[model samples]
Target: MKLWDYDAFILDLDGTLIDSGKYHAQAFADAVLAQSGYRLKPYEHHEFFGKHSIWFAEDLNERYGLSLDPQEVLKHKRERVQEIFVAELFAGAQAFLEFWCGKKTMALATNSPLEFVEPALRDAQIFNCFDVITTASDVKRRKPDPEIIEITAERLDVEPEHTLVFEDQLIGIKAARAAGAKVIAVDNGQPVNYPVDVAVHTWNDLLKLSELHRWNPN
Candidate 1:
């Protein structure tokens, strides 16, 4: 009865697998202000969490009428982030990955570019858990487009329907579901008016697998 029906897993990097949201939020605010002369309020940055860095730049550019390049904006943020980035695994992130590693084929999909994603995963000591990893540069599109997840599934040689994705943001949940994968989300203290196959307040809920089998992610 405790058996679940997922064949593969995809982990989201930022708030889902690691506790980098706080650092990322501050760095985003700093980078945007330094580049665009527009400062994002706390509410705005909180809403911006887990989004593609390039998307953030594009949104900011459109909103502020700035001519900042998305790639440059992302690069600036990465510099700030890399200076202070330390991987703090979210609750049960390690245990969850450890529990699922051998049981399921897995990969990581993120909108973050390699400059940021690689170091975070390494610092968390969970880098080896993934069989493959994909970032924004790896695909033509990022989250909310489904391309990244689909690409990850392709690289893993797994069907989308068999891939179960864990995410922290609605954008990622939307992307996973659009790519035909079931999604489990971490609360990250954010609002989730959207639906996922499962949503848990902490990774501790991931440790409670009866919860997963109860939902039957099919």
Candidate 2:
């Protein structure tokens, strides 16, 4: 059965729900280069997205041969990201939210920090669509680790098997699967090595499911 058959939906924040993943990557790259005097390749950016920002900072320090404080570095990167997000909405993001609101018990689950998620969602006018909002800050571990997904399911009061997780990265897909939930991958140009039950090219695909009989997300 398709995921929309579930009682509730959980959406990933970055590339899955918003078109601003690249903006995030660029902001990080800009922060890294400005602080470390090195450039991050596109592939490297893909590798870092959908994970915690501190890890990105630590990775940058190690990769670029800099001896910087990871927390401080992450703070700088997050500041830049917040600035960029304030002015732009991820492409088709609003449409997806409009399609899913109240149709299902929906919420947002992301590896992004609350500072970043809250401001961005507010700016995008989607701060309230989510019945539950979870971030890496609230969890001990990030995606590829099932803690967040499992925690969200518990908070939403839904069985894991009955929850549908929408994610853009393979790591996140793995997390949802490990949590015993069905996952639909959103291909925001990043490739997934493992199998995903559904791979959508655009948020429009979620909207298209409105026509499917099995997809009564409500």
Candidate 3:
């Protein structure tokens, strides 16, 4: 297949650029268990992988009658994630990003709070790759809201139509598309039922694409 060209880039943090999904998933499971004695199903891990912590908590509460306090659930999840999570970038993510750094102006737009994001990327040694960073704390809205993506584009001074986004979660994909950017769905063992421009299993798969498609001047 051919590439969809673009001038700027946006990436999702947890699953798209890093290998932190399992840790996050486990953290959610542990948090739920601790809060209400409920065990999250294996599929629940990725069901809301890219959403804000509060949203996940609300979903759990609404669906299971757990009455989980969003803040409390977030606290539990964060504590567990911090204690047991190993900060690691996905294989080839750093290499692929380094390759693209020379070619594109990239930004990070994740639902993760600023505190978690900065340290995670710093520890993973990929924090400096982005020209702009927009986390949950930076905006009033979260994924599927388009605020974060829109802000990232503005910070990069790139037009939304000229931007391309890498996302692994359906929520991220929805937000990227809502921001009017092309979406490349990164498969991180999660199922995305959205209509994205392209889907790949790893950053290397994109690196191997024949070419990245560029904007057409009419």
Evaluated with TM-score, which candidate comes out highest?
Answer: 3
lDDT tens readout by residue for model 3, 36-147: 9989887787775666677888988889898788898888998898888788877768877877776778899998888889999999988878899999889998888899
lDDT of 1 at 209: 67
Question: Considering summed lDDT, which 10 consecutive residues are worst modelled in model 2?
Answer: 209-218
Q: How far is candidate 2 from the true structure (C-alpha RMSD, Å)?
A: 2.9
What would you estimate as the lDDT of candidate 3? 0.81
Question: Candidate 1's residue-wise lDDT over 1-218, tens digit each?
Answer: 12256677888888888878878877777788888788888787777785766777887778778887777777778788888777898777788788777777889998888877887788788888999999988988778889999999999988988888888888898899899887877766665565633555578866776346646655
The residue pairs that clash in candidate 1, if any, are none
- On lDDT, the leading prediction is 3
Off by over 4 Å in 1: 1-3, 61-69, 196-201, 210-218
Look at candidate 2 and give me any clashing residue pairs.
19-90, 103-218
Instruction: TM-score for candidate 2, please give it.
Output: 0.85
* Cα lDDT tens digits for candidate 2, 1-218: 66456878888887777666777878877777877778888788877666556677787677777766767667777788877764354566677777768777987899888877888788778888999999988999888899999989889999988998888888788899899998887766666564734555556665566545444545
Model 2 per-residue lDDT at 99: 70
